[model samples]
Target: MRTLKFLLQKEFRQIFRDPSILRIIFVMPAIQLIILPLAADYEVKNIKLAVVDNNHSDYSRQLVSKITSSGYFQLQHFGSSYKEALQEVEQDKADLILEIPSQFSKDIVKENEASLLLSVNAINGVKANLGAAYLRSIIQDFNRELRLRWIQFPRFNPEMNIETPSSNWYNVHLNYKFFMVPGILVVLVTMVGAFLTSLNIVKEKEIGTIEQINVTPIHKYHFILGKLIPFWVLGLVVLGIGLGIARVVYGIVPVGSYLTIFCFAAVYLLAVLGLGLLISTYTASQQQAMLLSFFMMMIFILLGGLYTSIDSMPPWAQAITKVNPVAYFIEVMRMVVLKGSGLADIKYHLLTVLGFAVVLNSWAVLSYRKRA
Candidate 1:
């Protein structure tokens, strides 16, 4: 107990004594929590739209007004011809192009149907899909209104015949920031654990202090714990900053117990720190440690569902993520913070993270060299 206390005190002093380390440990996380959530929104808005109004009638004018009023799209180009509109989209000046066919109003009045051509840039698949969906919704609403005004029911109402009720849970308005903040926190914590710790450890070796530690009477596990404890606390502090930003800036409240989330965070910290320790043990220089750590961090984060949903990933990728600690933590954090899931809901993820922590820490302890 005394040894552990002494080691803890020593680690704290070392962390606080270095200005760079102090800033990284205390200030960086807060900055990331505040800036990333606002910048990382997936809910695309103000998409540039080009319009080619060939009909030159009240119906085409109304359709253009409806599309512009939806607030999802911004009218950037008013092309006189379909070729011009297509050129705007091809040049990346517009995300969508609406080409109203010639005599559209007359066709609709005569045949009760008119074809409106919609051309969308599919480079960004998600944004293009959203744009298409918004266009479809606006057109559908217009068609419904036209049906109501033109076709009158004799006795029964058509509204009673078709009822499509929809409800959204957890995120009612589907705020993309709320979904992204937690995932960013996971990425930041992983970067700190893997990249920062590896560099810090290798720095000691480069400075010749590792040799000094090798001659000390302290046990190897105690030294390793001393090195890792500070980083573990730093990770939790980052988590706190992220949570605060979610509540204050993004207005996202964790629906589950904070303690439960912290429990998973603690386990994740152990696994990440253990991986860093393993990296430090193998590398002889800080540059090597940093490069290796960076390579591993990228692979882990990409596989960890930081930007995309793991369930949507290919089966092979999903299977690989099961062995990645970052994936487990990301899953648990999203579930607890966003879905309000309890331990029972994420027991399998927790167990997997626990196993990773055990294996990594065991490897770190065994691999750490105490002698020159």
Candidate 2:
């Protein structure tokens, strides 16, 4: 225990003595947490819409008003002809074009049906699909409202219907920032912890400092713990800074207990920092450590369920996330923040990370060379 104590002191001193390491530990994650969440948002808004209103009747104008007032759409161009409206989409000014035929209003009133041409620019498929769907929903609502108003008059048959009102739970307004910020915080903290720890040992070797340590009576696991403990604490500190930014700047407060988050984070740091140490044990230089770290970081982020749903992935990719430490933490962050899930709720994930910590740190300790 005394040996471990002196070793930790040396590691912390080395970390604080270097200005570059200090910035990488404290400033880098804080800055990235502030910026990345805003950029990583997925909610598509401000869909540019073009309208070609050949009917020019009260019903047609009312339909246009319904669309623009829904807050999902912005009327970029209003044209008298479909060709002009199509030009708006062709020029990339509009994502969708709604064309009303010459007798559209007349047909809707007299025949209860009208033809509507929707031209969508499929360049950005997600935007095009979602924008078109929103427009169609707005038009359908307008049609229902028209039917309700028409029924108010002396119509022979009247039908009453039951409507199911739905509410959006967790995120009441479907705020994408609410979902993204926590996951970004996880990634930022993980990257800082893993990358710096990976580079630290490799740098020591490059400068011939590691040889001095290897010649000592200090046990191998003692050296590994000395390296792991400081960065594990810093990882938690980064998590704290991220949560503060999430609260003060983004207005995100985790509904779950802070204890649960910290508990998961403490175990999570072990797994992440252990993985870094494992890499450091195998590599001879900082360049090789960096290359390997980058490769692993890419795999962790891509499969981490940050932007994509794991359920939607193939069975093979889904199986890979079982071993991806980043995926587990990101999933836990969202669950605790969005669902108010407690430690009991994430027990399976906790155990998985614990297993990772034991395996990785043990591997790192065994892999380290004690002799020249």
Candidate 3:
């Protein structure tokens, strides 16, 4: 117990004395939490649109007005030439082009049908697909409006329309920040816990201080606990900072209890810190540990359902997420914050991460050598 206390004191003093470490622990998470949610938005907007108006008719003009007014698109170019509109797309000035045929209004009136051409810049597939879908929906609504205007109703009977209204659960405003902030927070916290711990032992080795520690009558478990506990506490501190930013900057408060968040975070940090300690045990230097940590972090975050849905991934990729600790934590954060999930709800995730903590920390302790 006395030996572990001394080790803890030394680790904390070492951490606080280094200005670079202090900046990384406090400053980096703050900036990333504020900036990442704003930039990592999934809702596509401000899609540039080009139009070729061959009919010059009221219906064609109304169609163009409806599309621009829908708020998803911007009118970048409006001219009478398809060739010019295509050139705008080629030059990257337009994301998509809307071409109305010369007989657009006449065909709709006389034949009750009309053809429209859409030329899309497929370089950005998501924007193009969403833009085309938005345009099509507006055009369909316009078609329905025209039909309603021209149709004659009998006095004895009236047409009845069925409407379906949708309610957005959890995120009433559909704010992307609500969805992204928690995940970004997890990533920042993970980076801190993993990268910092991974480099710890390696740095001591490089500075020739490790030899002094190894000569002492210290138990390996005590040494591991000393290294793990301080960073584990710091990891929770980082999580608190991120949650504060989430509340202050984005107005997001977790629907679930703060106790729940902290409890889960405590265990999650053990797993993450253990992974870092494992890396530290294997690597001989800080540079190698950093490169390896970055590589592993990339795999964890990318498959962890931060920016993309794990369900949408291929069967094999989805299988990979089951083993990923980051994926479980991100899912648990969203569940607790947005859905007001209880500890009972997250038992699966908690147990999975706890298992991770046990395996990783055991491996790190066993692999760490007092001599050699």
Candidate 4:
């Protein structure tokens, strides 16, 4: 116990003394938490639309007005020729081109139908797909409006309409920040825990301090605990700072208890720090530790459902997330923050991360070599 206390003092002193480490501990989370959620938005908007109107009729103009007014599109180029609109797409001025053929209004009024062509810039696939889909929906709505205006209901044949209204649960405004901030908080905490701990022991090795520690009668687990505890505490500190920022800046307060968040975070840090310690045991230098940590963290964060849906992934990718500790915590954060989940709801997540902490810390302790 005495040995572990002394070691904790040394680690804390070393961490505070380094300006770079101080920036990582305090500045990184503040900057990233403030900037990332605002930038990393999944909702696509402001798509540049080019229109080629041949008929110059009221119906065609109304259709164009309907699309632009929907707020998803910007009318970048409005020309009479498809070739000119195509030029806008080639010159990168437009994302999509809507060509209304000649006699469009005539066909719609006389034949009750009209044809239109959509040319999309497929280079940006997601934006192109969503933009085209948005335009199509607006056009369909215009068609329905036209029918409702021209045809008198209950006069000749009554038209049946089925309205399906949707309620957005948890996120009533469907704020992307609400969905992204908690997950980003998880990522920031994971990076701090894993990166710092992985580099801690390796820095000791490079600086010849491990030799001095090995000559002492300290147990391997004691040394590991000393390395783990300070950073584990810092990891929670980062979580607190992040949560406070979420509340003040973004107006996000967890629907669940703060105690629940801390409880999961405590165990989650053990697993993350244990992984870091395991990496440190295998690595001999700070550079090696950092590169390895980055490599593993990239895979973990990408597969952890931060930006994409895990359910949409392939069967094998889904299998990989089951073993990923990051995935578990991100899911738990969303469950607790957005869904108001309690400890009982997160028991499976807690137990899984607890298992990860046990396996990883045991491996780290066993792998650390003490040489006199």
Candidate 5:
């Protein structure tokens, strides 16, 4: 107990002695939690739109006004030709192109139908699809309004009775920031535990202190614990700050138990710290540890449903994410925080993260050598 206390004191002192490290430990997490959530929003807004109106009619002008008035679109340019509209989109100045045919008004009057050409950039497939869907719905509503005014002898008014009732669960407003903030917090915490601890251990090796520690009476488990506990606490502190910001600044509050979320976070931190220890065991230099940790972090974040849904991924890719502790942690965090899920709802994620913690810690302890 005395030895453990001494080691813990020493570890804390070392961490605080370095101002840069302390700043990184405390400041970086908060910055990332605040900034990344704002940047990673998936909600499509202020989408630049270009219109090529060849009809020059009142109907075409009304359509343009409707498209612009919809909050989803911002009219940037009026192109005279399809080529110019396409150029505006291709040059990244516009996200969508609305082309009204030359005989749009005549076609609608004679044939009772007119086609409007809508070209959307498909690079971000989901956003593009959503934008296109919004545009189509607006057009459909306009056409329905036209039919109601033009065709007065309507029997039963079939179109008016046909309604598509839509309700979004968990997130009624569909705020992408609310969906992403919790997940981003998980990623940021994971990064700190995985990257910082690994580098700290490797730094000891580079500075020739690892050999000195190996010769001491300090137990290996105690040494590793002393090194890791501070980081685990720091990660949790970061999680708390992030949650506060999410609630206060973003107006996102978890409907579930905060204790339950913290408990899972504790388990997740163990897995992340274990991974860091494993990396430190293999790396002789801080640079190597940092690089390896960064590469692994990228892979885990990408596979962990940070930017995309895992359900939408391929079967093989989803299977691969099962081994990733980040994936389980993020899944459980979002479920509990956003969905108001209970313990029963996240049993698999909890168990999976617990298993990872045990396996990774065992591996890290076993792989660490007394002498390099």
Candidate 6:
């Protein structure tokens, strides 16, 4: 116990004395959490639209006005021919094209039915889908208004229409940052924790201190715990800074218990720190440890479902995520922070992360040789 305490004291003093380490632990994460969510947001908006009004009728103009004023679309072009409007989409100036055929108003007034052609630039598939869907919704709303005014005798019997009201749980306003911040924050924590710990023993080896430590009376577990505890605490501190940034800059506060977040963070750091320590045991220098850790972190975060949905991934990729610690932490962070999930809600993840922590630290400890 006494030896471990002294080792921890030594590690912390070395950590605080190094300005570069301080920057990775504090400055980098603070700035990134503040900035990443802003740029990585997934909520698509400002879809450019080209309207081709062959009839130039009042109803066609009204439909265009409804679409443009709905805030989802911007009027990029209003051309006389479908060819010109299609050109706008081909040039990438427009994401969607709305073409009203000849006698559009005449058809609606005389036969109570009209048709319009809609074309989308499927280059950016998600943007195209969402933009087309938004335009369709606005056109549907306008058609309902037109029905209310033109034919008062009930077009389809309103009493029989099925209206589904959807509630966006966790993110009521659909704020992209609210969805992204927690996941990005997890990456920040994982990178800082893993990179630093992985480099710790390697740095010692680089500076010719590993020889001295190995010849001493310290146990391998003591050395491992000494290296692990400092960065583990620093990881939590970084999380604290990140949470503050999430609140002050982005107006995001966790709906779940802070205790829950902290507890999961503590255990997650164990896995990350252990992975780093294991890498350190194999590498001979800081540069090698850093490069290897970077490569591993990239793979982990990419598969961690931060930018994409894991369910949408290939079945093989989805299976891989089952063993990915980063994926579990990302899930737990979203579950607890956004959904206000209790321990019961994340028991599977909690147990999974616990398994990771146990296996990784034990592996790290065993991988370290007392006499090498």
Alpha-carbon RMSD to native, per candidate: 2.2, 2.0, 1.4, 1.4, 2.1, 2.3
Error of 5 at 206 (Å): 0.9
Candidate 1 lDDT by residue in tens digits, 128-181:
999999998999998877766666577546565576899888778787876788
Error of 5 at 339 (Å): 2.4
| RMSD over all Cα atoms, model 2 | 2.0
Q: How do the candidates rank by lDDT, highest first? A: 4, 3, 2, 6, 5, 1
lDDT (10s digit) by residue, model 6, range 267-360: 8899889999999999988889989999999989999999999999999999989888999999898998888998888888878888888998
Q: For candidate 1, list the clashing residue pairs, or say none.
A: none
lDDT measured at residue 103 in model 6 versus the true structure, 0 to 100: 85
lDDT of 3 at 146: 81
Model 5 segments more than 4 A misplaced: 121-128, 152-160
Report clash pairs, candidate 4. none
What does candidate 6 score on TM? 0.92
Look at candidate 4 and tell me the lDDT of residue 20.
95
The 10-residue segment with the lowest total lDDT in model 1: 152-161
The deviation in Å at residue 16 for candidate 3 is 0.4
Tens digits of per-residue lDDT for model 5, 71-137:
9999988967989888887889888888999999999888889998899999878878988998999
The better-scoring model by TM-score among 3 and 6 is 3
Q: Candidate 6 local accuracy as lDDT?
A: 0.89
lDDT of 3 by residue, 120-177 (tens): 8989999988888988899999998887676667632226555799999999989888
lDDT of candidate model 3 versus the reference: 0.93
Candidate 5 vs. true structure, TM-score: 0.93
C-alpha TM-scores of all predictions: 0.92, 0.94, 0.98, 0.97, 0.93, 0.92
* Native RMSD of candidate 1 (Å): 2.2
User: Considering summed lDDT, which 10 consecutive residues are worst modelled in model 3?
Assistant: 154-163
Candidate 3 regions exceeding 4 Å error are 154-159
TM-score quality measure for candidate 4: 0.97
Model 5 weakest 10-residue run by lDDT: 152-161
